[model samples]
Target: MPEYKQFPLADTAEGLTEAEILGWRIKPGDEVTVNQIVVEIETAKAAVELPIPWAGVVTELLVEPGQTVEVGAPILTVDVDPGGAAAPAPVTNGSAPADPQAAEEEMKPLVGYGSKTVVAKRRPRKTATATPEPVSEPVPEPEPMASVHTVSAPRGGYVPLAKPPVRKLAKELGVDLYDLTGTAEGGVITREDVRRAAEPASAAPAAPVAAGARERRVPVKGVRKATAQAMVASAFTAPHVTEFLTVDVTPMMELRQRLKTSPAFAGVKLTPLAFAAKAVCLAARRTPDVNAVWDDSGATAEIVYKDYVHLGIAAATPRGLVVPKIRDADAMSLVDLARALEDLTSTARDGKTTPEAMLGGTFTITNVGVFGVDTGTPIINPGESAILAVGAIRDMPWVVDGELAVRKVMQLSLSFDHRVIDGQQGSQFLADVGALLADPAVAITF
Candidate 1:
């Protein structure tokens, strides 16, 4: 007899209640060590790898890929006995036993480890068996005539063939998938077909779809779902006030070019964002309200002012939008800030950002300029007072010493919680940031 231990989902940061199973690193009958990663789970914030607490042989995986599991639910069962033999490989439904070598090769180790290659083998087709002949019977004739306008239901017990996402869309729209004719390959139902079926019969006729018309339905889960909820809450709860400023950033651009070739900034990818982040941190000292939070949870409403700057940079990743904080950003030099930003962006892009990195943000900056957009009113992150949006920098006509000349200019939009920051304070803060970028030398005055 073997002792079995169940592994439940651990409580994560931000009180995430559930996570989707992205992939499994270990399968049944594989031996795992203590603290070895067993699966990758995507939460509303990031993709996290779960490690087994007790070393054992994996007996069963209770959850499948793409399944959303609640916290404290048993995801896997493992045999904990040290001398217990590995569990026998389970047969797949409607398939032959997998090759032992192939199974062994497919089980890759956790992150940062090299994976072994497994050759793909096609399943052998099943052979037909001989059957006896059936006896013939007389068929009955129709008795009465029905209304001409009456539509009959689809014949046979066949159901529509559709992917999970398409099925979800049909369910949400309350459409009968079986009634809609599939337009995709192999007569499979698609998202567009469901949408067409969902339109009201009394409404105007929809325009004809062009050839090759297609649609893709992506599930709003994991980071994307969390981001949506946060944005909605912030937008509704915070009385936001947006202020815009156009700054001549020629001096900052010149500084960036000079820093790139300097020995002090070797091997670092510097960008305009680094300068913007520095300016925000420096100017935040004068406008402390911008870095403060409004707390009404206690007996009385209070304005909490933060002395340190935990700057957050909003990053758009394949998973979704995430804001990872650079702790103690006010204390770091320009070079240090650049290096920190590089690491933060790389980690976010790889979807390996930890939940802890996303907490304790005092102020945030979203660089929409990277996408070639001019500017956007970014929502303030929850628990923070303000957010800044940076726009594209282009050569524009500006008064340089009373003479019109083309200079590098960028647009900056700041959205602040009106409860914490007044219009005057917000305007002054925005102006200070603009002045810093317009002339890098102005930062010394602070």
Candidate 2:
């Protein structure tokens, strides 16, 4: 018989204890190559694609998609035959195959590799044309209209059905497969279809939720569980002092608009978040002291002037607040930064951010503007000495060229560990970010 091997989930990153299975790429009996993306998983930090480590034929899937599994758990089973196909079908109680068609159907690839039935449908037949009626003028033929069909199971039925997780996603977005256009192979519904349905139309109000909804209880695990423990410990152990700075951000907004039309930023989303991030990075360069670490055990201050920018973007997810760091933000162009931000935000919103994505953030930027709030004194994420909060941009009266004029303005709040950064140093960092926003041309100087 063919020897079966189990591939357990590996540690995606440090501090990640668990992950939710998003979906599988291959089915049972399909040959999978090394480094082929066979599975997609969501960790606390972000949704990441996982590649198969060894080349082999898939034998079994151990974990169902959408199931929350701990790190090191068995995820799938594979038949590793380095030489060639060696094993024969096992004789169950020495019984022989009675129905060949049933066996052939069983051998077909299912989503979980024999876990469920593939959806199938029937086909239509040709029809004869009616005899032409005796008339003086010939009847005009009707023009063929384009037919838009919803995605569904194949004519033979859906093979390799999506796991429970994908179904759950479909339900949350209020998507009826009967109404959506599927993009999966052979018209099978995919998770992407559900996501597309969730997007709200611009200028249209969002659908209202059911009144008096019951609270959902999700057991804390993975990156979310780790962040919670660290936050509780930090909040009580460290002294946090948050300061605010309201500035006119009209110039930064104007710069973002112009960049979107530029050849370099073509096809990239140039938003206020990009400007806020750039301001934070530039401000960090000016005041290195704000990026220091407070070592309580050593009873000394460690001011770190990081050579590279590991800027963390704070995301509020359904799981919890997770801060995933974008490594080497300083090396990224404005367009690249915007793309990264979009990807990171998408991963976070989907509850797939992994643990490795959460670690090693030198500084963090949280946008409270998405919530429509003016400003907030945000809590500092653990291990990081400082965090900057970007508030909603609003039009208000302000002094422009010594005259009171209406202009776009926003409030920025900075929170720091008092033990490491003094008030003067904190103020300087905040001032620098504000200055950069007031005149984005200063970014070129840096």
Candidate 3:
């Protein structure tokens, strides 16, 4: 008679379809209070902790950790009204419990146990004339199971001792767990065992379009999977046009060196990327087309231009490439931009960037310069029109006023969606950004 409540996996971000259960805070039979942290999940954007909406006793965890569940699917269940009525009888073939003792005896053991040998007991020979049919003819053994999900030999098709996600991973990698013994405690097969079994096959020549090979086959599931899908879709959907510019930035470099000792910029990790970020914001004012989106879903093709800039800084982490935005970046002072960039990047590297922080980016800047690369033709993010790739700032010989001199120089590459921004607008925007980086003092005129 207990009222059961199922907790579904909710969409943590816009267009997020699924998430992998990272861990559980409570188990079956554990008491839980409302607003208690129940589970941690990793979505496409970031990892998030979910809380219980109602107080209850954890009745069951429908899904195990490492299993990816779709949005709106129930991951756990609870008995919300456990004290209001009698405990529900054990469900066995739709029949009710025969007695209170039987119900009490069967109520426990909610957790799974490993399969044991099912031995058949024989009865003593009776005083009958018929010779009791000898306990012979032998008990027929089970056949060899073709799949890894089933245990082989004496256990027949009985379930083996492996976690659900481990089993899932084994099957995907084509590893036969029945033949390979697990190295885990109690001989429970793990993901490492499965991958080890698949090692020989992984070394074989990969197919033309295979996603993995060369000694290891990793299943793309989390951030890597999401990034690949997004980039592919953006490349195919948007017409990308990349432009480049090289500028002598001696003045800007001198200013940066001077600002390091300034009282206003004290305690701030002012970086060259921050200067590029500020430049992008100021340049967008003259070329709003670079900040617009192509809205083809409407009745007719329309361009939606934004008044403010949600500047995105592309950060590479252990997970994947994530672009977290600083909202209203154009309104911030140079010092404020420096502080925001520092915090945003550190949070991203720590894998703590929230999904909301990655959304609604109007423009993106990727510092390839950090890797000592010159420049790259970056692909535009789907929702935004432009992306700027900052190249390595190096000392090179330059001609200043028809006189040769050694100065600091940097390269900038801008990729934009041609459908929204014309060639002229894109060129002007790129030039303006280069001008700002070459001369930080030019920002006062804007």
Candidate 4:
């Protein structure tokens, strides 16, 4: 049979150029079945497991873990036919009569790959002629055991008190398996239990206690690299102007409470963010100038007007800030908008948010309210003309209907590229958004 070779990294998705090999599920010389997870690839969006398309014995592992390979790169090679498929011959070591059938049975392929061959060499054993001094004291009683396979009595048989994933988490966190009291069903270790035990309160922080220590080095790649380049370009090119307005959003809060019980908004969490997003969408309709982007690339240099509103929600996660957009947000109802917000936030948190989800935002909203911040002028995300910063809603006494009353107030900060949107247009946009938040019913009038 002719041997056919597979190329490295094959395009798994449209427009996908490169992917990093996260790990391998199987090793070389293993007989792989169709649909078996061979390797994992981290794409621009998420980490995905790639299955073997054909069943065969893994002949070679072409790539190593943590290596970023381009699309169509061959990661592994499989031998469809391992020649005659005859078992290796058995031998007698002069101890007793050998069972050839038993030896042949052992050599048969039970699963992927058989045992690998490694040459063994004998070395001279070291025996101290003179007794040496004690190296250290005996291990303490409270010390945890070094191995999981060697469980003592009453612990029961090989069921291993920890679930596979939980055990993985414990290993990653350097948590001692013996010290953790497994709360999982039937004495299995759970993820939550492991996580709690790994917390700073349970154990001291991992960093050395020395003062002015060196910082750890982490390679800046993927989303972080892309974000840095975009931010630098935007900050340098756009002449930014920031404007802030404090508004009494007591009415919007009341509206949210009332809508929570309405039949139109069942199974949805009504949040101030939803109200703010809706207000921004509605306001953009009146002042399209704020909704437009500056495209001076053309000869005449004109402001490009986009009739549709792609509302960008700036979310801060472990991987820094990511702005994922909701297309045609103006066309969606309050309930649908809330659902979309939840989806986008979840995706961003999981690091599965796509670049497409982050592109083509005309206007953006950053809810600094969650972080308990008063207000700050947010930088405009690349390709977007304006960004709205929504600050924390705090209860403060304000003049309402000619009377002093405790009301919920928040600061709305708008930063726009002055070159694209003039101060007059930007101010009008902010005023309209403020008006909607003041009385949500005003949005229906527009």
lDDT per residue, candidate 2, 1-446, as tens digits? 35444465655665456788767777666788877888877776556677766677886666666578766555665666745675543334423223445333333332221232222111111223498458798764432211112123343443334445656666565666556655777665678877887676788886677864433444566456667777788788668899999999898888788888899887887789987887787777878766666665566655455666788998888767788888988777777789899898888888767666777878889999989898988777777788899999999999998999999999999989887788999999999899889998877776
As for lDDT, the candidate ahead, 3 or 4, is 3
Candidate 1 Cα errors over 4 Å, as ranges: 82-215
User: Which numbered prediction scores highest in TM-score against the true structure?
Assistant: 3
For model 4 the TM-score comes to 0.67
Q: How high is the lDDT of residue 419 in model 4?
A: 87
lDDT of 1 by residue, 1-446 (tens): 35455566665555768899777787778899988988888888888888876787886667666679876566776767746574533344423226565344223222232232222222222333498446497543332111111122234635466664576567677677778778998788888999989876776787787774445456788988899999999999999999999999999999899989999999988889999999999999999999999999999999999999999999999888999999999999999999999999999999899988999999999999999999998999999999999999999999989999999999999999999999999999999999999898999999
Candidate 1's TM-score reads: 0.73
Q: Kindly provide the TM-score of model 3 when superposed on the true structure, using C-alpha atoms.
A: 0.73
lDDT per residue (tens digit) for residues 1-446 in model 3 = 66555566766776777898866777778899977988878899887788877788887777667679876666776777787886653444434244555333233211121122111111111124455566757844533322222333344444566664676677677777676787889788888888888776655886575544434456788788888898998999999999999998899889899999999999999899889989999999999998999888978988899999999999999778999999999999999999999999999998889888999999999999999999999989878999999999999999999999999999999999989988999999999999998888898887
Write one digit per residue (lDDT tens) for candidate 4, span 1-446. 31222324545544566777666777666778877877766655445567765666765666655557765445665655466464422223411113444333222321322232212111112334487767687733332222222222223233346543465566667677777766766677788988888777735567666753333444555456656877889999999999999999988999899999999889897789998999988888888888888887878777788999999998876656778899999999889999999999988898767656777788899999999998998888877899999999999999987999999999999999998888998999999889899888888799
Q: Is candidate 2 or candidate 4 better by lDDT?
A: 4
**Each model's lDDT:** 0.80, 0.70, 0.79, 0.71
Q: In model 3, where do residues sit more than 4 Å from their true spots?
A: 1-3, 81-214
Q: What C-alpha lDDT, on a 0 to 100 scale, does residue 209 get in candidate 3? A: 57
**Model 1, C-alpha of 99: deviation from truth (Å):** 37
